[model samples]
Every structure is written in C-alpha cells, then in structure tokens.
Target: MAGSEGPLRLRDWLVAQIESGRYAGLSWEDADKTSFRVPWKHAAKLGYQAQQDAALFRAWAVYKGKHLEGTDKENPSVWKTRLRCALNKSADFCEVRERSQLDISNPYKVYRIISEGTQGPGTILPLEGQPGLVSKDEDKQSPSRLAQEGSLLPATLGPSPLADHGYQAPGPTHSWSSTLSEDFSNPDFWLHVRLFYGTALVHEATVRTAEGCCLSPRAIPANAAAEYLLGPQPRMARVHFPEPPPGAGALRHLLPHLERGVLLWVAPEGLFAKRRCRCRVYWRGPLAPHRARPNKLERERTCQLLDTRRFLAELCAHLRAGRPEPEYQIRLCFGEEYPGPPDQPEERLVMAYVEPIFARNLLLHSKRLGSETGP
Candidate 1:
C-alpha cells in the first residue's frame, strides 16, 4: 500500500521533499545497505558527475590563473640589478660561472652575475686587453650605466601562447533550445534577458552597436528577484548560477522547469518603472512529467491524482534508508503579488511552476550493482 505511511518508509519522506523543495541523498550503494529493491543506476550517475564537475572547476581555476595571458612579467632591468647585488654579497665566488652555465634544472636558484666584479668568472673579468669583450675603455663606465640597458629586456616568459588560450573545460555538452529569438534585424537599441525556469534570471541588459562597450556578470544565489537592470550593452552580458538549490542538477526531477528558457523586453525609456511594459515570454523546455509514461497499473485511471504530500514523505523515508535512489523528481510552484501598471489598480498575480527530477544516469560500472544481484 503506497499511502502516506506504509511499507516503503522512503516514499513518505519523498512527499515532504516535493512540497518544500528539499531532497534526500539516495545512492545505489546506500540502497543495497538499506535493503530496498529499487535500481541504482540513476542515483550513482548523478553523484559521479557532481564530484567530477567540482574537480574540473577547481582544475580550471588553477590552470587559468597560472596561465593568465597578456599579464606583464617582472621587469628584466629590475631583476638584473637585484641579481647582481645578491651574488656580490654571497660567499660563493661562483656567480659568473653559475650565470654562464645557467642550470635549467633549477629555475628558482640564485641567478649568476655577468660583470667585472671580483665574484665574477675570470673569462668575463674586466681586462687591460680583452679586445671585443668588456674592453679596458668600456670598464670606465659604472655598473649603474649597464643596469639601465637590462630594463629593456622582453617580459614575456611563461607557458607557450597556445597553452594559455581561453578554452572551456570539458563537461557534458548542453543542447540549448532553438527558442532563442535574438532580433538580428533590429538596428534600434534593444535589451535582452536570458531567462530560465519561467523567470528572467540574468536581467535586462542594454544592447548597442557602438565603440567602447562592456558587460557585467552576476549570479543569483537563490531564485528570488527578477527584472534586474543589467546596465547598457553590446556588452557581453552573462548570468551564472552559483550553486543550484536542492534539486537543480538532477534532470529527471527538474526537467519540467527547464523546458524552455524565458525572455523579457527591457527598454531604456521605462527603466525607472521596472514594469512589465511589453513582450511576455512563453518558451518551454523538456519536462520529465510530460514524458513520464503512466504505470501499467494506473493505465485505466485517466483522472488519477498525484498527492504532493505523500510523495514528499515517501522520498524522505527512502533517503533515510541510507542506500537511496540517486535521483528524484519534485514539483514546485511560485507566486508573487506585483503591483500592476499605474492605470491598473489591482495587483497582478505572477505564478510560476518548477519541477525537478533527479536521475543518476552516469554512474560507474562498479556502482551499478543492482543488476548483478537481481532484486
């Protein structure tokens, strides 16, 4: 009996999760330990990706900083003077030899000095008769004079140019919908907003085709506000999600919400009002619910109702089992009261529905144990 409380304790918890937008960790291994019969492929895949993505992001950051392009190096002229002074003070009279035979094995070691100083090598020593070398006449000039020339040395030392280009790290390729309707013909100024989950996320960014343009990037920690003023554009504007809340990454669960990216119309004329002046969007992406084939048991019941509460409760029980399912799908709805236009007295009700489905589609073979031990 799959009711509010029954044999499947996990099912009850799932009901609560659906209503409040919370999820319980359900992995295949945990399911095995808990002794439930559900398959583990979906949950394992989800956990694997989450872990991989985290590692990839960290690697990308370190690589990017270490290989920053166009960043000027330490001025060579400064380095030369600094190296010369340090070598003169050192007790080892191997400065000139060390500089001439620069050990490539150790880049961090003290640099050698090439000069007529007592600590320098005999070959480069200031001479009464070395014709083409630092001649007797040239020795008259002070070290300070030589230091000035060192400054002109080029400052481009690091990774090869090809290694430092901005290449995006590897990950699952996302297939965006063709619903994007960027107006290529419009010559007048138009602001574009990249929206997702029935809400304008990035905000209204100003667009212009003129010299000197910039774009700002922002992220929403949580799903809260909309209609942001993302200052004027032609600027490369972007919106990023910091960390997805509860059920975001799990596609099987949240597929309905991400069915289509949303859009909005933001014009400079009414920037002050922040009103829904024009152009309401209605693009939708794929949804798990719409794709869910009804269970054969419920085939005849066309009006079968899904109890939100029961689902949440069952979900929790499953998570508590320890070996929980890797993924789950939960439904959510949002409502806000917006004061309509000045002429319209009533506040408009803005409603949005979000559904998230968790699926561990990419788990490693070792983690996929349910099949080996037939449930």
Candidate 2:
C-alpha cells in the first residue's frame, strides 16, 4: 500500500517500500510473505510481482556471492554449483565475488540490497517490530573495518543515506604537470615515476634536443655529436658541447665550454651495456647566463633532473655513511651540450634521465667496485 503510486514499477515500488520504512527489519523470507498481501488489478499482476521479487532475490544472491562455511552454508553443494555457473554466465552484470563486501557468515546479508550505494557504513535502520535488532558487535565492527580498509560497504547492515536520492562520491583526483611541479616531493609522484620506468638503471628524462634520444656513458668521435646511439652502428643527431672555461673544477675541466656543470658517476660501461666498468663524467649544465630563464617546458626538465640528483645524492650519502639503504628508486639525468651557430639554430643540450631499475644489482655492483678498489 505504501508503494502504490500511479504507474510505479514493481522494482521501484519495492525499493520505495524499503526506503519508507514500511518493510524495515523484514528478512527476504518475510518481505516475500508481505508482497503476497498487496492487492492488484488482477491475479496476473500478483504473479508478475512475485516473478519480479524472485528475480530481485536471485540478483541479490549473485551480487553478494561468496563461499559459505560452517553454519552459514544454506544451499547444497549442487545448488551452489548451479549458482556459480549462473553467476559466471552473467559476470559483467553481477558484482565480482572477490570485490564484494558480503561476508559468508554475515546475518545482515538480507539487508544488502536495501543499503546499496549508501553512505559510509554504520548507518542504522530501525526495524518495524524489532527495536534492538542492530547487534552491538556490528555497531563496533563497522566503523573500525571502514577505517582499516579505507572503503565503505555499499549496502549492508542498515539504510544508506546515499540510496535515498541522487548522490555520488567525488571522483578521483588526476595528476597533471602543474600538480607534479607543485608537489614533486610527494611519494605518489615518485611512485608514478617508478611505475612508468620499470626496474632499470636508465629512465626516461627530459631532452633539450629536437630529436629525443637516450644518453649512455660511451666514447664519441671528435667530429660526431655525443648523443647515445639508440641502437648499435646507426648514427643519430649529435649533442653540442663547447669548451669549459678556466678555473672550473676537475670534473668541469673535462667539458670546458658548458655552464652550471656537474659531475655524474657512471658505471664503467655507461648506463647501458651490461659489461662492468667504473667512470665519471661532467654530464649536466644549467642554461647560459645571457639566455633568458627556461620556459615552462625547460623548467620542468630542470626540475626532473634536480629531483633525480637529490634522490641519488641521498642514496650515495646513505651508502657512504654505512647506513642501510632505504627501499626506493634512485634516478639521475645525464646531459651533453651542443653548440649552435649564432645566426642559425640556438645552442641546445640533450639530457638523458634514468629511472631506478635493477637497484639491488646496482648497489651490489657499487659495493664490489668499492671493495676491489679499496674505497
């Protein structure tokens, strides 16, 4: 009678009955019993309602599907087999069993449909004839479980405030360049970097060259540009490097023409080739003084290299201090400057940024080199 409205569908009426507290505290068995009492235009209408109720019950069972053990096992093995088969056939429409919150032993399984898409757990639905039906254990457990798991059960144990009207949870936040620049120190940003690069010594980094290429420690012909070969025996665009100025440090002396120079300790074989070697190079430099400050794109590239250096310097310091290395990836950027003609294209550099991959192997390699070299 409560759900009797003009042209209201049976499923909609059933949802309304539960929401209006007309059938509160009624188990599936009891709700089915009450549905029989609804007066209809004809017996066929009554039969149709029954059919709808049966279909709804089946859907509920499938959505809440989980393996039952002990006293909660309600169906025979054969019935469960048939149910599993039916659920498998309708997998896309039904909730995945692994993802469902319905515990096999939960007494509140009958109320799951009523609470579907509700607000956070611990919502109390007062049953019509049962005042103390909300169990004390459930009252304490729900909030604790929600806190521990960081998720809410859609519908279970009570009425959902979310289900009463059109309500939606806030969408997940997406990371963009601005967001990354603002919070480069956030663990999530580093996690994303690690995920993108996988577990390798070489990582993808910002390049100043028109043609992007990865840099590795290796010899280059004097006439050729220093860009690392993407593959064996094929020459690529050369990176520019002018002479370094006098009074520069020993590392800077290696490349006299570059500005804002820094030394990068590279494996003897470079960041590529698997063979063992020990070497260092003056790999990165800042923009020239006469040049304007880098635009947004260049700033991002510089920030990436700086962040990588910070991480690696920390790691190296930790290793030198004889402290246990923290479980994290170490990243680095290698750069080579290319001098351009004044009237033609401006000078640019190639920066090869590497992600933390095969980290333990690198650590072991470093240790072995240190031991052999007595450092």
Candidate 3:
C-alpha cells in the first residue's frame, strides 16, 4: 500500500498507462513473444508516478549495472499482474484479445490490447512506427507536450531485462509470513537448519555458492568442516557443523543439544575475564532448561562460523526438496543479528537458525563474517 495515500482506482492508473503507451512507440499485436513485454516499461513508470507500491512495479534501469530499488522478497515486482489488474477493470476503454479467435491461429500465447475508440473494443493500436490510436482526451495536447512526452519514454532493456525487472513472470501465488518472532523451541525444533549462503558477492556468486553448498550430505559430523570459497576475490576457510547421529529418517535432526543456536556472548565486564573473551551457551537440552547462565562442566562444543555456514548448507538442500511448508524456520533479526567471531566486530551480524519454521532470510550478511566461536 502507498503510505498515506487516499483511495485508488485501478482505472485511473490504466488510463494513465494507456496514455503513456500511446506516447511510447505503442503497438497492439507483438510481432513475436519478445515484443509483448515492451509495455511493462509504461506500467512501471506509471507505478512510480502514481505513488503505487514500489514492490508492485520495479522500474527498469536506463543503463546497465545501476541497481533497481526495492529488492525485498515481500511484494515482488508484479508489474504485469498489476497491468492485467488495471486492464481487467478498464474494459470500456480497452479490451484484451487473444491473437486469434481460434487458439490454433496463434502459437505464441500473446494477447493484444485494443482501444475502444479505434474500432470499438476490438480496434488495435497501430503497430510500432505506425500512427498511434490516441484517446479523445489526448487530442487536447499541443505538439510540444507530445514531444516532451516522447523524451520521457524509457530506454528499453535488452539481452532481456525480464530476469531482473521481473517483466516476464508473476510473483508466487502462495507464501508464508516474512516476519519471525514467535516460533519457539520444541522437541522437533532443530530437526533441520536453514542456511543462507553469503550475499556480498555478485548475484552470480551467490548462485554458485548456494548450488555448491546444497550438495552437502543430509547431515554432517559433529565436527564437520569444509573449505568454502568466498569471493570479491577468493577468500577461503573451513567452517564447522554438528552431525546428527544415524537413523534420523528423511531429515537429519540437530543433536539434542545446540538447538536454539550456540549463543555467543561475553561474561559481565567486571568478571575479570581476558580481553574480548566470549562465552558460549552450551546446548542444554530439556533437563537443564536455562538459556544463559554460569557454566557447569564443559566439552569443546562450538565454532561460530561453522554454525552459520551449516545453516547455509541446509538452505541449499531445502531448495532441492523442501515443501511449500516445512517444520522449521530461519529467523533474521536485521538490526539484532547474531554476533560473529570472538572479536564481535563493528557491523551487525544477522543470523539464520533452523527452527520449527524453515526460513532462509538472512543470506545477505554471511560473507562479511570473519571470526570463530569459542569451542
């Protein structure tokens, strides 16, 4: 929703879009499937002008490598869906016609927009480079206004901007809540960890890392570690994971310990501990149900980066075979991210834990992590 805006009518936006398309080298029938997506530029521009949800229509960059805004998973760029929404409500002014009355006549599955004015509802706008079918109100514009509008047409995306701009596909029809505040510890909570590979690398690197990581075993040794390549330039390190004991079914569960995540914290400043010393919350299962406390006996129990990376590996596996809804989740506390390494550096460290809700939200901050947890 556009914050603080009054009520909206999809028809108004549709009228503006029709006008914008007319100004753009507008056409009715796309000569090929490739030409059909061209109108989305007008749809996106109108979205911005109307103060519509930026998530609904992410504008295309006129030049390469300029980051398009609004990159969250919430309300994905659905300009086409919005366009169809507006068109469905604007039947008096526009009509959608499949390329032919008989489906066999058109193999492309492309539909054309025809104006109510040109030849009633079925009248198509002239093909590109031909005279456009202007609406009655557009006749009021002076030649200079028309010229100014022409300069406003956006530069087209090539090599297909559909991938980044989302011009070709619709956002998913069903999803779960993006927020995570409530799911709690359960007997089944740690059955699987949700991992999100680092995001500091180029989008391509993110892809490679996730693909590379998803190949890990269903569960790793308690001390399992692997050398993963992190690159802006190559950076390598071995990260650790907890192995589930055998006979765990299609899923490998966390050991009875290490459930809510291995906590990385420091003793109170007056405790006379070493400089920058940190303490880990040992995985106290059901019997000793305390979150943080004075230590009892200890075993070499944790490595910080390893816990983070293990979650990453789980994410990859989830991609290959997880369902629409799974039993665990990955929670991301953006401003309240986990502390990474013993130094607990200056930037906030967001975390991904495998919980009752299987989430994959915090992959963006993983690459910057550079230290280890107390073992």
Candidate 4:
C-alpha cells in the first residue's frame, strides 16, 4: 500500500521509519544501504525508463563525444557531475545558494546524493548546512537563518572646490546647507543629510554604520523617519562637463569646485516642505585614509567624481523642463581623501535605507544613466 504512493509520500514514510528506529541502530544517513521496490504504477507515472535514457544522453553530451569505456554513461561519477552542473544552472539553485550563503564557486559543497532508488535515479538533495534543508526543529529556532550581515557605506561625494563652477544652492526649505549649518560638526547630522539624498554612496556608508552600531541594515531606527522622503522611483540623469584635455591631465594642478550647477523645485511633500529646492554642496568619495598608497581607489574616485558631475548637470537640465514631483539639486564634491586636503574641507554624508535592494536599484539606475550619456 505504501509503495503505491508517490515520492513525497515515500519520503515521509521513510523519515518516520528512521525516526522509529525501524532498522535497529541504522540512521537516516544509512537509508541508501537498503533498497525498496518502486511500485509499477509509480514507476510508470514517473516514466522511469525514459528518464534514465535522457539522463544517459545528458551525461554523454558533457563528454562532448569523447568515448567513455563501455555503455556505462549511467556511471555514478559521470552522472553526478552532469546532474550537479544542471542543478547549479537552475533558478532554484541560485536562490538556494543565496539563502544558504553557499560559495558559488564551490560545486561539490552544495548537494549530495541521498538515495539510489531501486526503480529510478538517485535522489539528490541540498547538503545538511543548506538553510531550508536543515531539520525543522532547528529551523523553528531561527526563522531567518540566512539574513545578510553588515551595511554598505558610501564610496564617494563631491563637487570639490575646483569642480564647483556653475553650482547653485537650492531654495531655503530643501537646502542641505541650512540643515548642515545647524549641526555642521555632528556626524549624526550628516547621517540625516545622506538619508535625504539617498545616493549609493550614502547607502553604502549607512550599511557600514549599521554594522558598527550593531544594527541590521534592514531595520535601522534612524532611517524610519525619512522613509517617505525618497521619491517612489529614484531617477538618474546625466550632466556634461568640459573634458580635461588629453595631455593636460598630468599638469592640472587643481580641479574645479563647481563645474556647473542648477536649481530644482520640489512639491510640498518632497524632501523639503517648500516648493523651491536648492543644491547643497557636499563631498563624498573614497573613505581610505590619506596615507594609503594610491591604487585602484584613486582611479575609482576619479571616475565617480566625473560621473557624479555629469549626473548633476543632466539633473539640472531635467529640472528646468519642470518635473511634477518636488525636486532638489545635489552638489557632489569629490576629494582624494576622507579628511581631504586642508584647503578643501571634507564633509561626511551618511545615509541609510530600509533594505539593500532599494539602494542597489538606485545605484543600477545611476550606472545606466551614466552609460547612456557616454564619456
């Protein structure tokens, strides 16, 4: 009677039998040592013979026509490799990898063959350490075992004094300058400023802050108040700045403070309560200490600065056309160091998001905008 049921029922029954100690000291791990006949009806329903043939063809394809010894394409070693590769390519497999925090590069660590069934192929299951594969009792103790750790911090900020040409402060209500003036020295105040802008740099920094504060990036208390401040869909725009002459790069002693600037307007519900928006100047860039050797960090900072400048310029043009929602201009000053140069004066902007997904999407959109605008 039990054999007539499908694999799901069979799995349950086998688990129960093992828990009951049906085979004396034998454990569930030893179930493969014993075999049970597959009911004829179940075998037919599963198309066992066809599945075996298909599995053999798949294994053969993996060899790319290289002749294997005999007709043993069903060899356990050969089939397992093909199966593992096939499983790894599946969407479910990727989801499992993310949830279990499994190393994507490690193929052998993910799954194991649990049973070589009598009627059909073996059953492959995620390994013991995989999240959903763990015992239910253990899962009950911690529902979200695969939660991500740590937050991200902003990579950079700008318009440096040298790059600040054409920049204009937004109107009073939406002015970041006004807010900063009230608490210019406070790191916490900067945190609020970043939250308002909600750029990728701010998001990354917020993640770092959450980790340092022992708070989950997903549920930072500071982010709760400004949740609605961010527009429903964060947008990306491109700004065009005069390109430095090819050979002039080496001799350029100083970058501009305002490459160009614009004014923006926001609806009453936008970041500012007033209808007018002003661009507030803030610097964001690599967090590495000034003493660190120049390497990829320097290159990245340069690229980010240029991109941000272009984005802001494009945004200014976009605002001039008139937008339906409240708008604000953000001035990004790129600097070489966190403390920056003595003359430049660095300002930190720390921002937080409810989840990394929102932050990631915003960054992606910005990248897309940059790409569309070209170098």
TM-score of each: 0.16, 0.16, 0.17, 0.16
lDDT of 3 by residue, 1-375 (tens): 213653333433333433456423223354442213223332233333323333223332111112344553333233333333223222222232333231232112123333234332122334345354333221133221221233221122112111221111112222311221123222111122232222211011111111112112223322322211111111111112224336633223222222212222111100000001122222211112222322221212211111222232333333334522212232222223233345654232222232311112122111111122113
Better of 1 and 3 by lDDT: 3
Error of 4 at 160 (Å): 35
What tens-digit string does per-residue lDDT give for candidate 2 at 289-366? 212222111210111121222223334555566656533332222232223235534322223233222232333444
The lowest-lDDT stretch of 10 consecutive residues in candidate 4 is 268-277
List where candidate 4 sits over 4 angstroms from the true fold.
1-242, 250-331, 338-375
Among all windows of 10 consecutive residues in model 2, the one with the lowest summed lDDT is 268-277
Clash number for each model: 50, 15, 14, 49
lDDT of 1 by residue, 1-375 (tens): 236533222123222322343222212122222211111121123333333222222222233232233574423222222222222222221222232322232112222212233321012222233222222111133211221233211112111211221212122223421111234332212222222333323122223221111121133222212113211222222322223345545422332332211212111111001111122212121212232221111110111112212222233334344444333221111122222335653322222221111111111111333345437
* Candidate 3 off by > 4 Å: 1-8, 21-77, 89-94, 98-375
Q: What lDDT does each candidate get?
A: 0.23, 0.26, 0.24, 0.24
- Residue 122's lDDT within candidate 3 is 20
Error of 4 at 219 (Å): 36
Report the alpha-carbon TM-score of model 4 versus the true structure: 0.16
Residue 22, candidate 1: Cα error in Å is 43
Off by over 4 Å in 1: 1-332, 336-372
Candidate 2 global TM-score: 0.16
